[model samples]
Target chain A: MIAPGKLARLVATNALSNRRRLALHTFGLVVGIASFAFFLSLSMSVRSVFLEEIFPLDEVEVVAPRVGAADVDARDALNDDVVNEIRQHPDVKEAVPRMAMAFPASGAAMFMGQRMPFEAGGFADGVDPAYVADEDFADRFVDWEAEEHEREACGPPPERECGDHYYCDQRDNTCHKRVPIVVSRTLVELYNTQFAPSHGLPPIDEALEGMLASMLRLEIGLGETMFAAAMTGGESPPRQVEGMVVGISDKAMPIGVTVPIGYMERWNREFVGDEAAEVYSSIEVVLEGREAVAPFAGWVQDELDLSLADRQGERFATAIFIVTALFVMISLVIVTIAAINIAHSFFLQVSERKRELGVLRAIGGTRGDIRTLVLAEAALIGVIGGLLGVAAARVGAAAVDFAAHRWMPAFPFKPDSFFLFEWWIVAGGIACAVVFAVLGGLFPAGRAANMPPAQALSQD
Target chain B: MAGDPIIRLRDVEKSYGPASAPARVLRGVSLEVGSGEFVALMGESGSGKSTLLNIVGALDVADRGHVEVAGVRYGEAKERALARLRNVDIGFVFQAFNLIEHLTCLDNVCLPASFSRGKSPAEVQERGKEVLGRVGLADVAGRKPGTLSGGQKQRVAIARALFQRPRILLCDEPTGNLDSHTGGEVIEFFRELNERDGVTLVIVTHEQRISSAAERIVSIRDGVIEDESAGAPAAKEAAST
Candidate 1:
């Protein structure tokens, strides 16, 4: 029955006397809250990691090998003929055909227990060199050394300088050019995870993945002079060149290495004859943006009536939520423990202030008044502890972000952050702490209320 | 000629510990305290005088009795009603002063009104300061009890009890902790408040010097009232009033 103002003052007066206890309770709450917040933020970040995994650049592929078709052969690919046809569609933004031609590349260096090898005949995707220069592309090729190596090549163009991405493979002085390929971010992740452990190789990040791609070199015949003689009767040998990785892309040819269209054309002209651009196994269609892709992809599937694969990006979001919810539930136990600590502290506080409480009762305060005063004290503690805990969690989350960015940059499924604190998380954390603290305060408040005023007053 | 008894008890009996051969604190004692009377209860250390005061003040229950304060009967009053009656109708001053050390003198005086609920904060503070001035501790209103001397503390205690102008003031050895001069001064002030303000004063004391200052004295032995005397001018004046 005490008024709120009086209750607050009473609570404040009593609480003000015990700074050390206040700090201790708040510290306990902070630990519980910070951990909960950190975990919640981590879960959000992790969910985004999976979402970005679908198409790192918001681009989905129109997969090949239709549901039912005849006379489809293994040599079929996303050829230029299919790319040109898709580009003619008014809805289509750009269609880039992806293909890889056999080429030679070799160079290896070990760093941090991993061999950074420039794969011979590096997996290549034929892309437009102009696309490689776009802002979205981070140069994966280490072209700074190309000019230095130019001075080291046989001589100038008149003297038949060995072309970029190629080198003399023998004492015969025959020179081959290196083809330029683009690396896929997905491949980098695969190498770090699926391949790194088995090969005794350490995982590489964006920088290291780019470095490995840059170091690669490839040639058309892998330095074989007999490639022309080994060709079909009318087919000619493709010019050998060193293939260098020029850039990395979001989506890549899933089956083979990537190279620019020029390399694919020249290789096909020599190895498969001039009719190489007729059929394609896979095609990638670019639409307007986030707004146009899903509809465009669906339209293509319906209009074209081909078997198209659209990776379900949001399906896993629900499953991840349930999992994250469970994790959040587990973290709530920490808050409960903090509440228990608060309750125990209140118990001791009530016992400590028994005589004072008795005096209050003797001076016209009702039993309810006494209980309310105690609970009010608890309420204040809950609020203070809850807010402090939330603040500490924010700091902890930032620390996690800093550490992750510094140490784990090449981690697969990377997002802007590995820990995210949404507004709900912070608000919910504070509310939960206060509720728990009040829950903890109830039993002791009741006990103090039920005590006989005379007996309590009689206590020294 | 005394006014109708505001506090009336009929055959009040109280005991402590075991029911069989219990140490009887009060036995079949009946007393009446009228409005505007200054009465003293005198007894030896184990005489149960304080118990009688506590019962009269609605602070303790009797084992067997019909007790009434301000027309609220003991057996019928709810705990809340009893508490409210205590707040609005009766006031108590214990030997310990019982002042909450954390609160300032004025706040201690305002404490009773905090429970009264209907009183505004401004009204409570104004009345508290007025009562403090009545006890001549108005200058020390903001000082905590711990900062006050024993006499100043007892006066502050009296001022707190006098808050809201209760009909009856029951003080148990209110001057018990003060030196003789300070104790005498507190007693004189109590007499003046009783005489001038017509506040009913029931004081329990063991000292004859203190008991003699009252208009009437009732002496108790064991658990029963043994003697009663009232021959003072104040009692005569109260009887005429």
Candidate 2:
């Protein structure tokens, strides 16, 4: 046995002399540790986003129609009358009826008026504009209010202008008086070509702001007018109509053309017939209190005998989350294998320092003293590596964000948006690195303990 | 004037390997050294001279033996007790010097004392410095073992062995690694320590020239003692009278 102080000195001397080897071992450990940290941080961020942002809003109470369920008929779609009745229920605060009508042969034409097949769907709904004002709903659907502000500031066009009326569309992109219409850039281009000559509208190649100012002409019930006279086997109405463009919007409507419910009802009664207005395809409801939302939605589904589809969307999102987590776990496995390699390297180093260890033993070193020296070295490696790994991850995340924003502005690559960096992630990485290092040294330390002093002396 | 022997061995047998093929290194070997006597064990290689020395110093165990060093039975002693005996009752000096290469000469000397009970760092340092001064290595106390010559390292080993004030000193080919001149110097230091301190000394060697320094010389052949000679003309005269 050797004195601990002497043993420590010997160990330190050996370690220092063999610094290059130590550094190599440490480098391996650090890389493994850093990889683990980066992956774990990413996993945690993704999980948090899914749990706190997407899942909570979509999954907690909502239920969706099961896959392969029968297509809902017009009568079974919970008509406006039934929807109104459901809203009058004590639990229900407000219920908005939604109707989706498929236009089979009436496809969106190309800008050049050469008919390209475009199957379209019409979504009609009676919704309180105030429902759009709900903070939670606004936070989800319209993330920014600046677009709305810009539309408001621009006001209405001359032909459609009405005094003191803040006209707005469902997409929140366009605002004006008579009837504000929000259309996609694609739709605007098409409309410009179709009506430019007869209506004196601007060309499609003009800038968006200029096209909106000159080319946009609204046609009241264009589809309905064509459908009516044809029902009696008469000549169809002209393919175009004359109306003023009220305002241009920032985005296309998510579902269909967002006409006011009053306008839709008037069009149905005058041309498309009253029978078409009776049924709704969906409903957007708002409860007075968040606590009442679940019960009201459930009661509406049961009372109206309508299968809800919101829950299915939630299930799909959950599946996505599981897949993402699996990917993260696979990355962790790779990091763990790398860490094991680091441990193996450290073990080899310990074997190389056998003579030095024997000297310590002869001088009076306890087993614990040797173990501490090895462990200390390992811990140092882990800490250094962890810091480097974190820095690398941050750089990686920044690069991802930059490329995503540059290439796909519509879908910004926000690293922090899905995977946030947390303190525990860093701590976990360091702990893992250190633990790996110590574990790596265990076999070598044991071999050192069992070595005979005489043999060790003779070897040197 | 025969006093109780400080070290005693009776019918000690040491062998290596299993019973069937065991190589009996020490067979029925018995020897004793009186307190304060300087003894030398001389033998050719493979004669178990070093093995006997190791048993007496508690560095090894005999398979069948009743052996005692400083009143403790070596065969029946536990590991802790054996370590204590090795630390306090016996000190070892090897042919290779066996100094920790990273330590300064003073630290090498002070090592055993650091492991012993009731010794502070300051006291250990002071004692180590004193012994290094005695060994004429006081100037090189701050230098590492790699910096010292072979003679210096052996001197440091001797100083280390003596610093603990053990009851017995064991040396195994202490000057084997050094040149003839430096070997003579290290042997002179051993003679001085034994003569001045009255510490019992057991030295194993093959060189007949080094045997003259011992007070008594025991020669072994084939693991058995062949001859024993009394040391000094005065001790021989006294024995004759």
Candidate 3:
């Protein structure tokens, strides 16, 4: 048995004595590790963008079959009871009911001191607030009417200050109603890529997205539209409800606006009948994970007579996973080749150090000690090369990000950096380097250990 | 052969190459050295003297018959125990003075201690320095072997061999590469170690001057011991007694 301290010193001495050979062996390992880290980070980042923003894999949108479809029935209409039934399902994490505006409505907003009418009509829907609460800009996407009631209980007055995206009405000394609305990220992406270039508007950077939401003032006419005449013919002119863009969320409707359920229920009750307000148009069931999506969707179809609105999420997720795995497999092959290079380098090193190893054996070092010395030398190379490799990968990623952001066209879900440098990726790259290096050093260490001590004695 | 036997060999044999045609280096030779006795093995090249010395030092094994060093039987001992035996109970001084060229003289001296577990480096260093001082190369402890003269390098090798305070020292022509004066000086050091410390010594040499200092000389030729005689020092010591 050799002392650990002495063994380390000997390993360092031997490994460092031959700097040129050490550098050559380490270069191969570094390139392999860097490739591994870069590909894994890039694929993971792309997969995250696809699954999280483009088509969320954990949520399934359920809707009733359209009227007059084969085997359709009136009992398939989604309501509070259906929503509760789906929510209480063991596999469902959350089930948020959504109601579309039954009557025609239109909206206009003041932008850059000019009144701009929404030419597509107000195709709006309302959902439970929990669906968008985790968004980055969700701090203000609350129901103002419900917040006013909660504030009213705290005694209106100098003590109560207006919350974010709200205004204190001086005349009543109470928070007046300003309906908060959220637009989908898809709508923003469409405007950025399609409309911004033609209209000569500066592209909106996501860093200032919160400012974009707070600055827009939208006014929706309850029973009026540019597309059609009001359905409620007995209406005494259209009532206008003022709303503010509180945030943008992926959970919102892709081509329209979304508001808190309370606002939709109230507006629907006032404009249409109580029946319209009570029936939900759809329910977004958020499952525990991607694995739960299939079973939960099946349960929804079998028990509640609801079908998924789209199956694109599951398909997209599977495609991303396969692509990521393929890239990872390619990286692993590169690393294994580098490991073979390491083994060749070590074979030469052991051959060169034969006399030294034999001399060590003569001085009472056992075969195990000799083997450990060679392996420890290899491990040292691994640690140094692994650190350098990860750093090279980060540098490579930065260069790629810089080029992409500067030259690539603006598109949907285009991340600022294509690579995501998570902690595990960096650590895993280093660990893989070390494991491969040790595996490469095994046979050479054994060769060095088994060399007879008599050879050293017979020398000279 | 003046004390209890510390090294015993009986009909030991060794050969190399394939069994179809073997080159026998030692052929059923037997010898013994008492504890604290200074003996010399004198032979020509290919005379099996070095092979016999290697078997005595636990660096090589006999093909047949019994051999023992101190109290441990060589045939039955495992390699780990043999390594410890070579590290702690026996020391080897080679003719080439095979000090590692990259290490300082003191580091080379401490090499043996590094193999033995539980010895702190500071303690090893202190012992290494002491041995270097004993070999009169204390000032050269920090210098690499390449920078030293042949004499200094041999002294360093000797200091390394002495690092573990072994009871038996095996020298395979320890002075073979040195000048006459340096070789004589090394022989004097061996004598002093044997006389003052009572350390057992088995030196293989052909030099009559080196043999003159030994108590007895065993001459070998053609893989077999041919003659054993009391040297001048043994006769002188016997007359004094």
lDDT of 2 at A118: 33
lDDT of 1 by residue, B1-241 (tens): 2478888889999898887879999998888888888889999987989889888877778999899988999899887888887788888887888888878889888888777787778888899999999888989988889999999999888888888788888988887888899999988888888878888889999766667778788888898999988836565777888
Query: RMSD, model 2, all Cα superposed?
Result: 9.6
Model 2's alpha-carbon lDDT is 0.60
Misplaced by over 4 Å in model 2 are A1-13, A45-355, A366-410, A416-421, B1-10, B31-37, B56-58, B66-90, B102-134, B138-142, B156-168, B195-200, B226-228, B233-241
Specify the poorest-scoring 10-residue window by lDDT in model 1 chain B.
B229-238
Give one digit per residue, the lDDT tens place, for model 3 in A1-460. Answer: 8888888888787778678988987888788889889988998898788878888888888888765235656433899888888888988888899888877777887544546678323479898787777886566777767743533321245676667545554335555557778888888888788877877766666675767756677877766663334455544355566678877777888888899988898777767768878998888888888888778777777777778887886787788788778877877787788778889988987776777776677778888988898899988888877888899999999999999989988887789899998999999999988988898899999988887677546864
lDDT of 3 by residue, B15-115 (tens): 98899999999998999999999999999998999999988887777899899998889899888888888888888898988888878899999999879
In angstroms, give how far residue A354 of model 3 lies from its true place: 2.2
Per prediction, fnat is: 0.43, 0.14, 0.55
Which is the winner by lDDT between candidate 1 and candidate 3?
3
What tens digits encode model 1's per-residue C-alpha lDDT throughout A1-460?
Answer: 5678877777787777668988877766777777777788888777667766544334556656433344454345445655676678776776765544433333343345444555433344465554456634434422322333433436334676665445653333554444455656676667776777778776766666557544544333432334334543434533334555555565555434565566565555555556653444356666666566667666655655444454565446667778788877776887788888988988887887777776677677777887788777777877787788778877777876788778864545566677778898888778777788888889999988877666565525
TM-score of 3: 0.85
Which stretches in model 3 have alpha-carbon errors above 4 Å? Answer: A52-56, A64-77, A101-106, A119-123, A129-178, A185-214, A221-241, A262-279, A301-305, A309-316, A402-417, B238-241
| Deviation of model 2 at A136, angstroms | 9.2
Better of 1 and 2 by lDDT: 1
CA lDDT, candidate 2, residue A391: 68
User: Which scores higher on TM-score, 1 or 3?
Assistant: 3
